[model samples]
Target: METFLGIDYPTLWFLVVGGLFSGYAILDGFDFGAGAWHLFFKKEESRRIALNAVGPVWDGNEVWLVIGGGALFAGFPVMYASMFSAMYIPFILFLLFIILRAVSIEFRSKEEMLWWRKMWDISYSVSSIMLAFLLGVVLGNVLQGIPLGENFEYQGGPLLEFLNPYAIMVGLTTLALFMTHGAIYLLMKTEGRLFAKLTILVKRGIIFFVVIFGITTIYTLIYIPHLSDTFREDPVMFAVPLATFLCIANVPRLAMKHRYKLAFLFSALSMSFMLMLIAIELYPVLLISTIDPQYSITVYNAASSEKSLGIMLNIVAIGAPLVLAYTVFVYSTFKGKVKMDETSY
Candidate 1:
């Protein structure tokens, strides 16, 4: 329970892990979003433009996910083991689709055959959509609580239990959110007929997201009331959801005004706020237990030793900035519209 700046090691490590995942969601979100729109661009040039829009930084964005995973294992080994064990099938499918998506991106252009390119195009789009949906499914299950027993082991039934109604709703919501996010990115990178198409898509994306988000919100309030308990107890936490709504609403408004840069920023902000809300709702508790309260994994119970967390903090302090700088540099270097050339993705 060693304290730094009035915060303990476990809480600090929790923030670190949350921040890393938030970084991944905001950075690679648009990448997944872009890929999610792959099939929409039927023309070969349009598809190539869409791919190249994310080419410079798609792989680099995944660095945050890798770091986030490592940090989770290092900081909360028990939570990592138990959560992974419980969601083994979903995570495995996640990994498989990740590889397929990467392969689709890398191999799509290797051969110019129509069938070859079309096949990979479908693969890329399907993989991206599924990845986004699966992420939401995992998040839904976490929010809904897992059936954990002694030693934090899962006490759930069959693996298919992971696909309950709530999880599927969240999955579909996540897909819509990411699709909207991707449309905003494409709007920024495309022009002419493509830009016009994206403009229409962005509008549709907004409606799609709003409808799904509304359903998810109502469902959570009615069925998953516990998540709102924190906000009810602490009035200040209301700001998080309020900000999220504002950001979400601003996306379509800004897009309509043709202010895409700001729209994209708001889209990213909307993502950041959603995650912040999750953190607000789940702080101290990493994984909740449906079996019993005693079986839940809290930051206090699940964290590594104080000394270990302190050491890792030092490493992250040094490494995170470097990673941030690299991200900024890459984006800055590739800023503005994607121009096709001899070496475009």
Candidate 2:
């Protein structure tokens, strides 16, 4: 446990992994949210506008997920192996939809045929929704923990265990949150009739997310006691959830004021704060064992050697800024409302 600054290598890697995944969630989240509204836009032009809104950065956004996965594998090989093996089914479906989503985005405009476009639109929306849901499901499972035996292996009965009520609730909440985020983005990138329509949709999205988020919070407080243990110990940590609440509340207020950019910023902040809460909750532990606490895989026990983490940290230090710069450039290049044309997605 070599220390860097005031933190150890394993803890630093944990933060790295958490930050990468949080980046993925925030960057890709709005695009997935946009795609979730694909089926709602019946007009070809509206759909195209929606697609083009995210066309420039969707693929690049996914790069975070790849980097996050690689970081996880590199930093915590044991947790990666065990968790992936336990949730193989969900991960496979996630991969399948990831491929389907990319194909849908690419192929939807290749043909002018009505049915062909319709097919891809359905594929894209469905895939995006499923991807968000599955991600939340994985997170929920991680929070709730699994039946881990000796060697930190999953000892659950079947894949069905992954879809319990709590996980499903989390999945739905994730979808709602993303949809709300997407709607706000659409609000920013549209005007006139479309903007008016999105305003109403954004209100509904706000309602949906609020109700579901409230339920998820209550459920977590009541049932998932482990997640709140840290907060319970350090009462000051309550500020995180408070900040998350204020951020979520600010989104609607800002949206009402026609401050869509600020709303989107707050939405992104809410997500980051939520993920920060998760990181705080799971600090040392990567995967909790339902069967026995002794069997849990923690950051310390699951991490690679200090030398390996040190090398990768240097690599990430150099590479992450490049990725951030690229992301900023892409968004800046395509900022403001989307205009449809032959080149449109």
- Candidate 1 residue lDDT tens string, 1-345: 688899998999999999999999888888888898889888999999999998889999999999999999999999999999999999999999999999999999999899999999999999999999999999999999999999999988986999999999999999999899989998888888888888888888889889999999999999998899999999998989999999998988898999999999999999999999998898889999999989999998999999999999999999999999999999999999989999997
RMSD of 2: 0.9
Q: Cα deviation in Å at residue 235, candidate 1?
A: 1.5
Query: Model 1, 3: alpha-carbon shift in Å?
Result: 1.3
- TM-score of each model, in listed order: 0.99, 0.98
lDDT (C-alpha) at residue 231 in model 1? 97
The TM-score that candidate 2 achieves is 0.98
What TM value does model 1 have?
Answer: 0.99
Clash total of candidate 1: 0
